[model samples]
Target: MIRTSLASAPLRVLAADATPVFREGLRAVIDRTVGLEWAGGTDHADAIRRGVRTIGPRVVVLDSAVDPTCTLIRDLVEINPELMVAVLFRDHDRSPASVRVAQSSGARCLLSRDTEASVMVRALLQAHQTGRYVDPRLTMVLSRPWQSASACDAGVLLTARQRQILALVAQGMSEPDIARHLDLGAATVSSHMKETRRRLGARDRAHAVALAYHVGVLPLRPALVAQRGISPVRPAHTD
Candidate 1:
């Protein structure tokens, strides 16, 4: 099993959700978990912003329904680029659209509302340390092969490492996280990201991920599942 070396420091985390019940329960959960601390909790996006600034937690876990847009997530990241973010989603609400939204919004980890407290804490700690978390179910999603541009297709040419980085980006790891995972420098990751945006005619990282998905370079995990044994889904616009 893949594992990250444990950090000597306990991870500090901030929790944000409009629901009082969820916030309290999550706080309790994290307090009981090892190597994690519940810095504070908030009920509004503005309050979350304020709390994160005040406490300077290593990670912030937000309720997905509370902030569904990419703009809001990006704003939070801009508030503190070093803060790792996780989104709390409902199990009944899992869908391709939701997954896409979560990725576009810069959430490195996702926890189902039905998830156990222990699981939630574990996920939070993972994000705090590695900048990415994949629950057993989501891990399956992450492992699916991303679509590559067609052999004859000409606009963008991505090297093998670039393609791997694209997949990690689609999985919502920040530039530094990608650098850490790939053992490359942050500057190198930034360079590859810039090239991806330029080659795919994308405006930003989220846009690049969307373009990759739409153009068939990264097929939704379920879509690929349904096609079992058939010819692989071609990258978009290949024909």
Candidate 2:
């Protein structure tokens, strides 16, 4: 089958940030990437609302500048229930506590502004397909004592091993593959996966990945993935 290009893409994407430069950067990424269209972007929340209503994009890459607390994710979702959002973490709002709040705000994807373009694309695609994703780097920040205390005072924490296993799982790695990659027996990897599920209270692999997005521990570089059979979900919309 021929690859899909952005122009023929069934769904569009847009950027929403206060900075003109940031919007341009997103536009560039969208222009260069396949499977997405640049539906244009805005610097205001109201404009973003209008754009979503008008453009009806499948995904939006947003900056916390629209709302420092990242509450806008929920509001944007309210406007278009099928829309997926990937939040950019500015220096000011990249704290573990803020990131946690943003992730908790139903943000499926959270990545630093400087994350690689491929990661950004993967994030937008991931959230669009699965409803959850977060840059694994953010997990380091959240693992800190102060960050965890502030973000998840409930004290729900995953060990580094657990985090690594979950990250591999998110990469669509199988138990044997993960075991081989990590230089561990298949049983060991299986045990770790089970424990991770228990810690995250996930019903299965998919649920565990979704919950990992909540705790800030999946999807990032240094852990490569071959995401196969990924097809975007384009919901019906009215003109």
Candidate 3:
């Protein structure tokens, strides 16, 4: 319903950035661009979630500097499923791994910090209309194939419903909250969760979450930066 009305309106674009220059520049550019309006800028990821729900922006331009770990995109998407996130990556951070990290964190579009003003504006419009836009300069990076090392990247796939439910679980949402959020009955949500746990070979909800992070099916919470890449499970062979 929110997105349906935004189709004919000037879709609002919020900046999940704290930098003065970047936010001001984007605001100025968006003000002049047709079919796009500047919603506002958020200094931290916490405020981003609030703005996303209250402001109802169709797209969010998140600066990598503000969210270096790229964890906020997934949470924002959970708040508004229709939202599109475009990460503003640093020029030096152009690599196949970096692209995959951003995509895995739920960013649908990528833009370089040094990208031309005109190109950035074009990308925003493209994301709003078509739901994606990658920086043309990064096209070569995509040519390299991704190596599958984790279960998530291997053959393991989660159904859309399972992924959504698991995401809510990752945020520490209770089953009832998830049910209300997704408009599913509590029992239905529980059933999907049980299946997800079984698929991951998790013993419980907490175990399911840990395995989800291990498999790259979920991104690490920003607070757990120091623990990044450290699996919670110890290999049986280690014994």
Top candidate, metric TM-score: 3
Model 1 clashing residue pairs (backbone): 147-217, 215-236
Q: Which is the better candidate, 2 or 3, if ranked by lDDT?
A: 3
Candidate 1 CA-lDDT value: 0.66
> Once superposed on the true structure, which residue ranges of model 2 sit more than 4 Å away at CA?
1-8, 151-239
Compared with the true structure, what per-residue lDDT tens digits does model 2 show for residues 83-123?
A: 78888887655656567656656677888888987778877
lDDT of 1 at 199: 58
Which 10-residue window in model 1 sums to the lowest lDDT? 146-155
Q: Give per-residue CA lDDT, model 3, range 147-184, as digits (tens).
A: 23333252344677888899899889999999999899
Candidate 1 vs. truth: CA RMSD? 16.0
Instruction: Estimate TM-scores for all models.
Output: 0.56, 0.58, 0.59
lDDT of each: 0.66, 0.69, 0.71
**Candidate structures ordered by TM-score, highest first:** 3, 2, 1
Number of clashes recorded per candidate: 2, 0, 0
